[model samples]
Target: MQAAPTPVLLSSTPIDLSPWLSALDSVSAAIGDIPALLSLAVEAGRTWPQPGGGRTVVLWELLASVSAIDVAAARVLEPHLDAVAILSQSAQAFPDIRPGAEGAGDEAWGVFAAEAPGTRLEARSAGTGTVISGTKPWCSLAGSLDSAVITANTDDGGRAAFAVSLRHPGVTCEQPEWIARGLREIPSGSVHFEHVPAVPLGGTGWYHSRPGFAWGGMGVAACWLGGAVGVARDFRTGLSAGAEGGREPDQVSLAALGEVDRTLTAVLQYLARVAARMDDGTLGSGAGQSTWSEAQRVRGTVAAAVERVLTLVGSNRGPGPLAFDERYAKRMADLALYVRQHHGARDDAQLGRLALKGDCPW
Candidate 1:
């Protein structure tokens, strides 16, 4: 008998992500149920956007959707989304590997490319294949993901990417390394690859130097912006519904609300422009702004927007929402953890250096 064909995943275009959004809401409100979380991940995988016109559209929509629900869930989902985006670009970068280019399935994907000095994952050439051995930290969904796009040091002292299966015989994932109360569901830890067989993805310097790599970094900002929006919703809802308890919101509270709206609006517009530029292929070297500089610039801007939203929400709403509303509290905490992906003053300094060289492509 012939095997059954894999069903086609839904196109995220004409994007209606209500089901997954609802799932996220349920998971966030409830105290982090593992089964529910897995179900949501599956939904996300199935609807993961393919490379096309609506890619960035689906990205912003999904980030906002997940952020509006819960950031921990966003944390779980973002890496998978990033992995897909990375692999999608890698396919073009190294067409010879024929890496799987399909959307979400039972086999989830993550990107594990964090580098540790003196502990690089060396790729050993074996016949027409390669094997990776070393420790990779900051690996999200380490044990859970079926496959991933990992980076390794090639024998020639250059870097290369590999598609490695987690279930391979020599692989071992270190559990419970991610002990933070926020984003606790995302098991970001270390994974040990001991002679794990793999398929090479791209050549030396390709993974970091690619234009899409920077574009993908900016995609992360979209998720952070969405999470901030999610947290700000509590403030919006509460202020509009009257003040905490029964008191009317004062001028101070109203001012805070204004700032929240302005911050989110600016960040949202910036994200839209960046996404459009990315889709139109105008976010590159000759476009007057290198993708790397553009990504850093936007990431920094969105990161600041996230801070402003959090500050405004906290100061305006006070602690009532944080103490009483479980969802609001979780989102606030989650957003706090997620935005730390930005490097703060260091990133700002890098942008300053880039600006001194030439005009930035915004």
Candidate 2:
């Protein structure tokens, strides 16, 4: 058999992740506090890393931080980091696309561009600018974020991306529509835009077509992996504390821990490989193929790892943590909610189809 083509790397260098890791550590204690989470997010934005930083560095740091912090806090903060990641790349990829002060942020930002059925944001030309009108659903941190990168349907039947201030006129953020008892800090719901003025960032289709878009998808996986880590750590701590009391840790607990460690170790290696490929601009870039597939694979793997960790932790520890441990209960709730971002069988089917088409030739 002919050897498969080796993926090429545009650059090779280890990413320095100390700065972002330290920043996240400084705020780790406050992660469970909703108000503090939002505040620290903005504070991080104010000192967001400059250009010339490698992609892996940003992604690794984000993953490490999210792993150490609460999942609810990760939900609130990850999108903001995603916003910066998106706009930062856009600013580099497209010279005309420059972020305003708010987008540059002394405050929080979100990418409110999920175009699900029944919800729409229409973009219309207004004088020299554009105005957006309609309801945008699943807008996380809608009321709290200072600004957002909104995707709206244009007159040409194509979608375009814009940077809009959340506090601007004609924008109405509604009460959170979440019924789940988790990720309460992220008040995601509908936001109505009635002629809300917006500045165009990139032309039609630029948002989805950019390689950085797929790169940002990996960032989401980083957060998922982090949540899994958080779950694993909670179980490990409990196991350790139990053992410290003089009795041997149960075999069931040990087996669960072993499985968790193995799964997480595999995930960590996968993440590192993807990060390196991402840093070199190869993992998710192609001429005609969808870049999103790479990130989707990572997301799928991490989601599975998270599920495994949750199951093992619950089965091994039973209801002790759930009934008495506040932090553990919260972590479980938050992670359960967050990992649902994966579309289950549907996503798997899509990935299978992609594989069949040779988009993934491993």
Candidate 3:
């Protein structure tokens, strides 16, 4: 008789990573799924920032990996995390960033938005030296931010970005009034800088011209993918609980959940492939208009996937706050707001604009 074939087994299990740190301690001594593995890197980046490697892809990968985690983590980790590694890593990730004049300070990059009705940050330059002012709405690493990348009307009457130190007596982080849904873990508060001394990272128009200006968006697609996994986990948990309670996971619910899972999975593949291309130098133009267009499409897909999950889970408020079934509500709220950074408005508009130009490959 032929020896019994090894049973093919599959589990829809989620691993609690807090317990396992090394590859040796990984669950079942097996490589965890990409989502879980990615999450570790993301959280690690947040809790243990590598300050010196600022210009390396590793720095941005860390940031982008955990970019979607709420602001709360940003605050908690600010004190404990290895900040020096983060800066050093960022410098390496984007080697183009320059050290300021001896007295001039550096600024932290945050993603609230552009073309918004706000002036949380401002910067002015005279020759090589620059003075920055105003408040930043959502400075990601604000508490520990060396400074804030500020924009303001110059004396000559032109808009500009200036690197302003947060330690300066002129700058202050205010209460974050509108706590958006998703990335609440970050210290996304407003900051006001008054006559803060600063230095231009590049020439008068360097910051805007940086390749990362658009690269940031594409990298963040991974975060959305993470959120999608979170949603999937939540969905599965809900279904299991409902099943245990003898409630059948209706067809509509299963279908909705599945769709969200499939769509998000597709985009996740897209992000990973494109990211690899970027690493390999296959995908040219990090911050070109085309990059923006593709990012928008991915963002829209993520948004839709989240919304589909929300709908499948139902909207009727259940007993107490915890009892309500808002499947991915918290995450969705965060993603809805975050996705706009790709310049995405509606589901259709994601690839709509791109269609006008031409079809895209995968």
| TM-scores, each model vs. reference | 0.86, 0.89, 0.63
- Candidate 1, residues 1-362: lDDT per residue as tens digits? 52221111123433255444455445455446654565566566566664234567566666666656667766666666676666767777667675765533566678888875656688898877788898888888777778888998888999888888998989989885566767777768778999899877678788898776786677678778877877777787787677556878888888888888887877777776767777787766464567888889889998999998888888777788788988788788878888898989999899888878875744
Which sections of candidate 2 miss by over 4 Å? 1-17, 46-58, 101-103, 285-290
User: What is the per-residue lDDT of model 2 for residues 1-362, given as tens digits with 9 covering 90 to 100?
Assistant: 53221111112222344445455655566765766777777766556552125556454546445654677777877777777767776776676656654455566788887867898899999998789999999998788777888999999999988888899878899997578777766768999999988878788998888776777676777777777787888788787887798767878778889999999889878877777766576664564346678777888898899899889988888897898998788888888888898887888888888887777736
- For residues 1-362, write the lDDT of model 3, one tens digit per residue: 52211111011112322222232132112221333333333345444323222222333233332322331222222222222232332354445654422221222233233444655455555566677766556555465545444555566655655445567777777766655655454435666768777644444454444444445454454444454455455667677788999997888767766776676557655655555554565454443335555556655665566555455434421233234544345555555555454443554665675666563543
Cα lDDT of all candidates, in order? 0.72, 0.74, 0.46
Error of 1 at 343 (Å): 0.6
> Which of 2 and 3 is ahead in TM-score?
2
Backbone clash total for model 2 is 0
Better of 2 and 3 by lDDT: 2
Clashing pairs in 2: none
RMSD after CA superposition, every candidate: 6.3, 7.2, 9.0
